[model samples]
Target: MKEFIYCWKDLEPISHIPSYVSLTFIACVLTCVGFLYYATNTLSGEKNNAPVITTTFVAIWLFIITILSLQGFFLDFDFRPPKLFIFLGILMLIIIGLFAFPRTRAIIAQMPITTLTYLHIVRVPVEIVLWWLFIHGAVAESMTFQGVNYDILSGISAPFAGLFLVGMKSKSKLAAIIWNVLTLGLLVNIVSRAIQATPYFHNPLMDAQPNIAVFYFPYVLLPLFVVPVVFFCHIASFYQLIFIKEEEE
Candidate 1:
């Protein structure tokens, strides 16, 4: 496994990154799974097998991405549309599809606003991982909080927002909307910076180095799983806050 991972010219050796970094990221992934499971279970209320189906589907998707990343499929940027872009496009489509389908919309409507808000707390550890990656030369400094990335603020404020702003009150609903929008902006800011820091479009504003860590395993999960989940939560929050009546909440 080490050999296959290191064979990629763009990847750093396993020894270069601390074990805790990977462990922490894996923990974050598990936390995401827990969030999704809780949401699905809450919606299901044991009336059906939807939670199991949802978890199985997500696990299979993660497994496929893990296998592909280990095989270095996304590192092949020589093509007209780089595999990285292709992968990102697929993730975007999956998120869009959830919004597009009415069945999924019903599921999203049932997701607890508090859970969606608190789920962002996972980003706090993710920001720490980004810093570790920066120090290890796996990512550009611009992707960390020390640089242009303000996404950490969203993570830090998540708990507070979840605790105070998520309620049935009209003012609370509006505040939730504002919170989700601001955090969603932060998410977009970091994702755009990450794209610019990549090899295909290395903007000088980011750093002297390109952000290549995400092409590797575990790290690839950042873009593949974590960011999309965060994006989904924000959009889901918006749908509920804007469309669902205050009495419904």
Candidate 2:
């Protein structure tokens, strides 16, 4: 493990951010990563050993992001396009590649729709963390339910949508499809709001608060890992409901 020396700039924010919020966000991060591993392992099966490789790769990617964040690499707001945008773009391309490649698409398709549906429950904690961040001045109200973001609804309804599939015995994929589409729209809404709130593209009309908290360590994981995973879950859910045939439960 490489040693990271923390400077005063990196250490100052720790005193302001509440412990509970940090712990809760950390838990959500673990859950999201663990859930993805479970879903990947379930679909890949023991024969392929894909889970080990995929999870290892994800872990390494996250470690690099975490290190950079702790070093304040993303805190520079003067850079055009922003470091956050660059990393997020990379993540978007990776997601697209997962769905575009035949072999990877096949593996992703095998993920149980029910599992994908419930995986969103992690978002509930995410919203809470955002709300807390707002209270502490780390993020803007526009990113929380009190403002423009309505993503909490998606997290709250995830279980019901998953249960709807179970209750209907997979007889209808329409309910899940509608839910996924609506929730995906919600995801896009907040993500757009977040992007606009970035320091480089701060929109005064949107809210007085700027979304800079994510440029810090731990919180940086929100964009680097949590949001992307949730986005992928919604996309995966859509792919399963629409393109793949649903077998009776």
Candidate 3:
């Protein structure tokens, strides 16, 4: 274990921003944008409105992330726990507010359940990126499928679940509900392990090398942008399942 940690620590990055890292970061950002476009387009019920809203939201989100990166917010490990909680709290508030507003609730209800399921397929690539980061020794093994992170299973199953939800003329609401619940559990599991592995969490088990890659530029986008998007996707799926009764029609 000591040798493993020593080796990981010794493998320093050649540059702060390498080519593969840049490509992965760009891919992540584009995935977020694509999902936002699909969501706003589906909810707005008008092509023009969808593009406008999608563009606005994507711009604002990107701007916020850029500012955070420029300010080196994610690099501050000492104060990360509080900052992470604050960030997640703000996101949760926004989600709750969207669902609370009647108009937004109606819009959310109109979002296709299959598309929501398909959105989760992005997790497969995300897990792949996590593995890559692990290879570079940027993160702890606990954050990847090689260790405690099993969230990749959901990503693996998402497409089939999505197709099942869509192709079945008489969709099984119970099956969809069960799948969402199980995937949500998987998400929670990885998120909890990630938090525990962070330096701020003071987990002695990972003291030799904590999950610090997420606290840097480009990679920071994972927690700030991608994770929340995934969380919202799951919530949106549940919301559609519970509130929208397709069988009644």
Candidate 4:
């Protein structure tokens, strides 16, 4: 077994001084506070309104939370699960039901659109933390450098630079389609690794631990959300137009 050394420059345990639990608690408190403030304002029927979902604000929030989450993972080698995990879990269940049940589709579609909009606000950040854990080469870490360097994109200011480009329009439609095809191809690489691991894919880093149990196919939503939702959601839903035509100014 390789000896593990702690790099104190980037990480500190939440338990020792300011624990991850404490930060989670603070985030929860602030979340509730923010919700209450909005609820009170809405009930008062003020002219100035805050929608339950704010796309631009939520996008920025997701990115900020993701960066902060990396710190917690580095400190403990485990992405600190949220204090509001139950809420998020319920939200996930509703989304899954909406997506999977055709009979529920029409009814679910009628729900306040803002709910899904803001829910993704919360979802994106959580996924980012999970992604960081796998990259950090933790017990469930997949592909990491030296089993310590969590960041595959070490030099770049925004490791997720591709995120910005994925949904944006390019001069080349041919190129755009090609990029999507290439992405789907890349995911196939995991299949080979999965086969090699066989009946069960265990985390080599941890004895008697099965990393593949919770994060199996279909449940392996990290990649799907990355390319399909974040990247392509805007493309089909926001970019190309089949019905609505833009009028010349």
Q: Which candidate leads the pack in lDDT?
A: 1
- State which candidate, 1 or 4, has the greater lDDT: 1
Instruction: Output the worst ten-in-a-row residue range by lDDT, candidate 4.
Output: 240-249
Best by TM-score: 1
Clashing pairs in 1: none
**lDDT (CA) per prediction:** 0.83, 0.80, 0.71, 0.31
Clashing pairs in model 4, backbone N/Cα/C closer than 3 A: 14-19, 14-20
168-219 in candidate 2: lDDT tens per residue?
Answer: 4543577777887899999999988888886656666877767778888788
lDDT string, candidate 4, 187-224, tens digits: 33333333222213344444221232112211223322
Better of 1 and 2 by TM-score: 1
Candidate 4's C-alpha runs over 4 A off are 1-51, 54-137, 145-170, 187-200, 203-249
Which 10 consecutive residues of model 1 have the lowest summed lDDT?
1-10
Ranking by TM-score: 1, 2, 3, 4
- Report the error of model 1 at residue 126, Å: 0.3
Per-residue alpha-carbon lDDT of model 3 for 101-196, expressed as tens digits? 887777677666677787788888888777777777566787889887888899899888888754346466778889989988988887887777
Q: Which stretches of candidate 2 lie over 4 Å from their true place?
A: 1-14, 44-46, 166-171, 247-249
Model 1, span 1-249: residue lDDT tens: 234323435345444898899999999999998998887788844565668887997899899999998997887666668777777789889888988888888888888888888899999999999999888877888899988899999999998898889843424777788888899999999999898887777765648667888988988899888898889889889998899886765
Candidate 1 residue 117 C-alpha distance from true site, Å: 0.6
